[model samples]
Each structure stands twice: as structure tokens, then as C-alpha cells.
Target: MNASPSHQPHPAEWTETQSLLPCVERDLPAGRHQFHKEQLMARIHEDLRTTTRPEPPKRRPNPFLRRTVLLPAAALALAGAVAGGFALSSGDPHGGRTALATGPALTTTVGAADAEGAPRLLDRISLAAADTSTPTPRKGQYIYIESKVASTYTSSVGDKTSVVSEELHPRQVWNSLDGKDGWLIEPGQTGDEGITLASEVVMSGAYDVLATLPTDPDALLRRIYRESDATRDHEVPRDQAAFTAIGDLLTESYPPADVSAALYKAAAKIPGVVAVDDAVDATGRHGVAIAREDGTGERTEWIFDKKTLRFLGERVVVVKAVAGSPFKVGTVVFTSAITQRAVVDANKQVPGGAS
Candidate 1:
């Protein structure tokens, strides 16, 4: 239930300062710093563009740096996939289904697995989760995560109409084990510099917070219910809030075996969770899913390996029609495949990549 920091506008003159300043100001050795402010700013701009903009305006390339300068550390945490669709399209009233290139959204007409489906599948998943071992990251280590992510937003080009755009890319994050620091490392680029994990970082992505979560199903569920209530202010349905909380936890955090098992079991207690026997991730891996439909005309599905019971990824599909949304029933608005995760020694280090 951690809230991301809201976006705040920065000084308009920051862009002018950036464009006017030299990458290397003083007489400095070439490799002493091994990083440039402009490069880091550019990388931050790109990240902001993908996460926050549908189609960023073309005024200045560095304008996004200003917007992103405002996103908090937990803002790097991916949005909860369970609340609604991934929003592959901007708010384009006339936009077509081009964003559905990965696949069309699955219509709600497709029946979810029966009421008994969740308990049975959850029992198996919980068992597997309990049996599996995920190392508890130590301080000074990095929790490295690699995933294929896609996001969408809408932009109004004029007073008359708007255009929707979607961006899909591979993202990697190296979070400090202590929840004190982190880095967002785009491929082939030095990790963006100076990321500080906020004290209120989301439970799912914060190692220290994950260690503190309750491992008992009933207790865990109650805790999530209460916390989500406080954060969402009862505006979101209890079940939806709980489900979204679980979704964020499942996708981003690797809790201890008992806590992980408890999360799945707790999800089963939520009223609307249903089973989907057939689901596919962005990586084209097929698996089963436990899903819930929100009032917002979308179904969030957490896919898991059918045989091993390992979580594969999550996806969002449109189930109802909405005005000003370029999505239709059965259109897969967003999909992400978690390709890998590991603990590393430094923020700049990834498995089999440069240190």
C-alpha cells in the first residue's frame, strides 16, 4: 500500500541550464567520474517518457528530465497490474488497435474457472512457494530484476482530438538490499546515477519491508486489507485493493518462502479471485493464472507455470467498453515477463553483465 510520490513541476529554467552547461565543466580526468550529468539526465528522461508519457511533446528532449526529477524512488516500482488494464493506448478517441500488436485483449465473455478453482490452484502454488528457496538478500547487495515492460498513455494534440501511444521495452532495476538506494539500468547504458529508495518505498519492492510482512495467510490478508484501506481511502473496493496489492507484491518482491506462500493463500480468501487455465506471458510462455476483475472493465491475471507453479508474469485485458479509451474487449492492454532476478554485489552489476 505504499504511495508513490506525485509528480511536481521543476523550475522551467532547468532545461536552459542543462542545454547551456558543458558535460565536463572543470579540468577533470576522463575516467575519474566515468559518468556525465547529461547522459544520466537523458536516461532519466527516457525512463520518464516510458512510465509517465503516452507520447511526450517534442518541445525539448530534456523536458522530461524535469518531470522525472519529481518521481520518487518507489515510483520506479511498477504500477499494480491487478487494478485495471495496463493502458496500452493513450486516450485517443479514434485510435485503432495498433497497440494490440502483441495480441488482442481477451474478452470477458470467456468464462473464468469455477469458484472452486482458486482454492485448489492456490493450494498447489502455496506448496511450491513454500518448498522453493529464494535467498534473503544481505545489506550492500543488489536485488537485480529484469523484465519486459509495456506502458501506454494518451496525449491531446489539439483541442479537437487526442492520440494514444504505447511503448514496450526491457527494463532492469538494481535495488539496494537495505531499501536505501537503487538504480534503473537500461541496456548498454551505465546505470542512471544517485537513486535513493524512499523510507516509504512499496512493500513489494523493498527487501526490508518484505522481511517484516506477516507469513500467516489470515493475518497477511487482514494486514493488506487494512493497509490498502488506509492508502486507497475506501475509494477502491476492498477486494480490488487487496488483489492489486498482491499483484504488486508478486511481480516485484521475492519474499521469504513462508511469506510468499502466505501471499498466495491470502489471495484465495479474497472474494473474486478466479482461475484461468490458459494464460500467456509477454515471453510467449504459457501458464495458468489466478485473476480478478475490477469494476473498471479490466481483468488482471497473474500467470504461473502450470507444471512448476513458478510465477511467469502478469497481464491485463479489457473486459468492458469505455468512452475515450481506444481499447476493446479482449484486447491485452499490458503484458510483462520477468525474465530473471538475482542478488548482486553492486548497483551497476547485473547477472552476466558489466559491473
Candidate 2:
């Protein structure tokens, strides 16, 4: 239950979030974030203008820069909406803009999810995670991750209503071991110069904190549930919160091999977790997935490299269609693919310093 919520980045400004400055995917309390999201979503009633909006069904959620999980299912429906929906829709609602192409929101065919295959797949995923190698960020070092992502959300112009998708764009983050100093560069969320990830930095998103967690699956599960209790939305089942929290951890931060393995193994213990054979990450790479549908109308899928079982990224898709809702089944609301992650020596310094 990483309880630090102040320094979190929720999906960029949408209808409800228009007043707040745009940031990346968030991992804050479900009560506040969910309340804000569901309240605004409930207001959607007008039919989407065919000229600007897609037919429906979208995805995204979040990762790398772990923020409170939510969106394009407004974060789950893709950043957990197309970024938590890839964003609550990237950036300002009025412009509905980003470096990604702007037009109709992104949609996709519904991939099949299998409950029976989940556990076995998770087992293999756990082994692969255990064998995976990651650089350790020491003191005076920074954890850097780069992702290609987008968001989906309902928008309006004059009297016309439409769902807009930010063209896919790159999101970069730099976090120090202390979580007190960092920077973020995402077109819709920040300026080209980016913003400091300070003042709001929390231990929850720091690599050092992840290294200290218990590696035993059962014990780790207990720890996650216990920490999540304070922030859990009363409407959400604890199991779902635990699962989403784990998704945020896996997608957004660099975890130790043992801890990563434990997280996967623990995911197997949760009820309702499933597997999808036909899944794709934000990078357009196809692979298997481990997913779960929360109380929200969307499902979150963690994608993996098919051959090596290496984690690629995650996406959110609408599993259940809501009446009059802007999104439909199979809509990819938010999506993110990690193109690079490593231990860098300075804030804002990229891997290989190429970008």
C-alpha cells in the first residue's frame, strides 16, 4: 500500500481533470481518483459525433513513473484509460492534443481472456521475471524509463461531442533512489523542458523501496493488501486494488528480480486473474497477457514478449459496455510500451544519452 499520493501524476486533464495540470499516469487513492473519474464519466450522455469520434472500444493504464492507477477505462480502460485511459485523455480537454496524431480515439478488436490459462501462464511469467536481469540504481544514481503511450477521453467542441485520442508519444521519467529528485518529459503532460518530479516524489515509486519488499509471494501479498487498505475505495474489492497496485508497480517502476518474481507469483494467488493469448503491447508487439477486470467497466492487461516472456508493457480495454458511455467493448483507452529502462547517473539524462 504505498500511501504516498501527493507527488502522483494522474491521467492528463480531461473533463473532470481539466482544472489540474497534466502529468503522467497516477497511483493515488481510489476513493478520490475514482470518485473524480466516475463522477465526470456519469455526465457523458450525448452521442459521439461520427466526424471526430471513433465507433468505440478503447484502452490504456499506466507504468514506469508509477502513478495512481485509473483512466481511459478512464485509466484502466487504457494508462490504466488509454494512460490510466493512457490518460484520463492526454493533456487539456479543450484542445485534446499531444505529439500523437489527433483524430478519432484508438479502438481495437476484443482479445479473448482465459481464466484457466492464467495461472499456468503466470507461473511461466514468474520464472521468466526471476531470470530477468535489471540494473541496480545505487545512491547518486537514477532510474530512467522511456515509454511510448497514448490516452482516450470524451471531449466536446461547441455542441459536438467526441472521444479523442492523443497520437502515440514518448514519455520519459527519471527517479532517484530517494524519490525526492527527478524529472518527467511527456508532450501532453509537460513542456519539452519537462517538470521536476520533486515535491511530489514518494517512496512508493522509488526503486529502493521495491528492493526492500518481502520476496515470498504470500507475505508480499499480505504486505500489498495491508498497505492498500488505507487508500482502497470502499466500492472496490480489496483483491482488485491489490491487482491494480501490482500492475502499476510492474508497469511503472523497475523492480528487483526476486521481488518481481514474487509479485507475479502473488498475482497468481488473487482470484479472477486471467490470461490472454492474443494481446499486443503499446509498441505493436504481440504476446500473451495476464489480466483482470475491476469494478470499473474496463480490463487491464499486462503484456509480455511471447518468446522470452519478458515484460513489454500494459494496456486497458473495455470488457463491458456501458449504456450511452463514450467507450465500447474492445476500445483501447490507454496504452504504454517501455522502449528503454536503465540506471543513469543524472536526472534528465537518458539511456545512451541519445534523446
Candidate 3:
């Protein structure tokens, strides 16, 4: 069993946020910009984006990396933060790394979600995934995934707190199948030249790691629960963790076809999983969403094309607002669209052999 991550601050993160405790009146992990910006754009940020979901109902926010629905997902996303260049300061006296580009807080029509619609939608999605072909990376090949990502978080400066969003930006990552080697490039987060991914294996989101998981939905689901145990926030339900871990795999990972199918099937088994009739990605592509509401007032949605059942992107929305929350209902806290995923012959090589 993967035990839940202890609610202790990671040394580096503590160094990053410890001082802000006296100043930040809002709750969040991974320091966000303290800007006067009037709006927000939510992004999954994955291991690439450093945003996080809100904390559970009444608990004091844990600034620890465990702020997101899945700790592993944050860990996977941290791969980018670890292999980095400096963050662009958004006029922070606190030295928080945030982009200067800010946008209006993203909003959406609150799509109706059928409480029981998950299983059926997932089944269709599973069939679609199983029918698709996934390429296996060669020894020197890299898995390139390019996405448009944006994020939202509360920024408190001087007594005024407002929601801020990073402008939608491209995030590109090239990972070796084994997870050992990779590259990351995001303008504000990693800089223009990008950085080498020389960090530890992104255990849950790695293609090689996912390739080894069981394909049987039942078995796969059980494994998911076990692996997700580590990131469990006791205030939050364990099923949310499982759902989130699966969400990480489904979004950031390029799993094998069989594993992909099994993941959708496994997601169907998680309680509270629902199907949203309408949702949009960071790029404005509309799709159906398979979502799980973490009691923490946010619904993490995985959007897929309605016709092809192909995944388009992920969005986290504010469904039920909490007291003192800067977000309103229908507020989209995060969104990411995977524009491309392909097997590249070499590191940092994009599709069509473009570098």
C-alpha cells in the first residue's frame, strides 16, 4: 500500500512558502502571484503547471505539495519544476515565481453532470482507446507531449486578495519511456530554451511505468487504489485520490492502448465519478467530461471529444464555493489541452521531426 504522504512541508517548498504564511491570506500550495489582476485562467499545470486544488472544507490549507487532488500528480508535475530555469516574477516582493501575463478569470456554463453517466461514457471511451494504436518508444526515442496550460490561484498582497490566472501558454515535454531522461519548456516556468529532465522517474505518469500495469479493469482499479493511498488526504475521500491518480495517467501520460482502456474502465468504478454534458479545454475545444468532485468545492474534469471520444483536455471548476473562497460558482480554476502527442526519434524532437 502506498501510504499517504505525510502532511509535512517539503524542505524546498517550505523555503519557498514559509515566509509567505504571514502575508498570504488565501489558501494554496506552490506560491501564486500576488497581483492586482482582476481575473483567472485555471490550468491542470500537471507536473508542468504548479497550481493546486483547494483544500478540504474546514481544514487549514496544507502548503505541502499535497494540495492537489493527487500528490503523485503534483510529484509528476514537479519534474518540470525540478529541472528548471527561474520563474518569472509577477511583481512579488515575496519572490514567488509567477508569470506577469494575467487574464480574466475563466468562466463556463455550469454543465449538468449525470451522477450515473460515468460508467456508460467511460465504456464508450474505453472502446475508443482500445481501438487506437499506441506506439512503443524505441531506446533512443522520446514521448513528446505538447499542451496549452493556464492556472488560477489566490494572490494576497497587503490586505487585498484577488484571483489571478496565468495567461494561456504552451508547455512542452519530451520524456524517455523509462522516465529517466526528458525535457521541459514553458515560457514563464521553465524559460524559452527549456531544461533537461534529469530528475527521478515520474512514477505514476511515466509511459514505461504505466505500460506495466494490469489491463484488467478490476485488477487495475485495485492497483490504483493502492498506489493512490499515499496521496490520501484524510479530510478527503480515498476514492477522490484514486480518481485523481487515474486522471493524471489519463491526461499527462501516454499509456499503452490496453492500459488506456483499462483506465477508463477503472475510472467507471470510482464513486462520485460523473459525466458532464459540456466542458471546454484551454484551447476552447468543447467536449464531454468525466469528472469527480473532490468535496473541496472543485470538480476536476477530464474532457473528451463528443464524437471521437478522443481526450481533448482537463479543467477544474468551482462547483460549490466555500466561505472566503475568491472563486465563484462556474469559475474555472484550471485547464489544459494536449495539442499533440507523438513518438519523436530524438529528445526534444517534435512531430514531423521538428525540434
Candidate 3 local accuracy as lDDT?
Answer: 0.57
Report the candidate with higher lDDT, 1 versus 3: 3
The order of the candidates by TM-score, greatest first, is 2, 3, 1
TM-score of each: 0.67, 0.75, 0.74
Q: Write the per-residue lDDT of candidate 1 for residues 124-240, one digit (tens) a residue.
A: 888887887666677788766655544322234565332232334454555665544555533211123323233233323356666777888898898878755544324457787
Q: Candidate 3's residue-wise lDDT over 1-355, tens digit each?
A: 0001111111111111111100111123111111001011112223333331222232222111122222223333312223222122212233223333655566778789898888999899888888876667777777776666666666566776667665776666666776666666654554456655543334345667767888999998887677556434455577876776676566555678888888889989999999999987777778898887877678878888788788776677788878977789987777666667677888778777666
Query: Sort by lDDT, best first: what order?
Result: 2, 3, 1
Each candidate's lDDT (Cα)? 0.50, 0.57, 0.57
Query: Per-residue lDDT for 202-277 in model 2, tens only?
Result: 4454667678778999998887787655454568887887787677666556678888888899989999999987
| Clashes in predicted model 3 | 13
What's the lDDT for residue 21 in model 3?
9
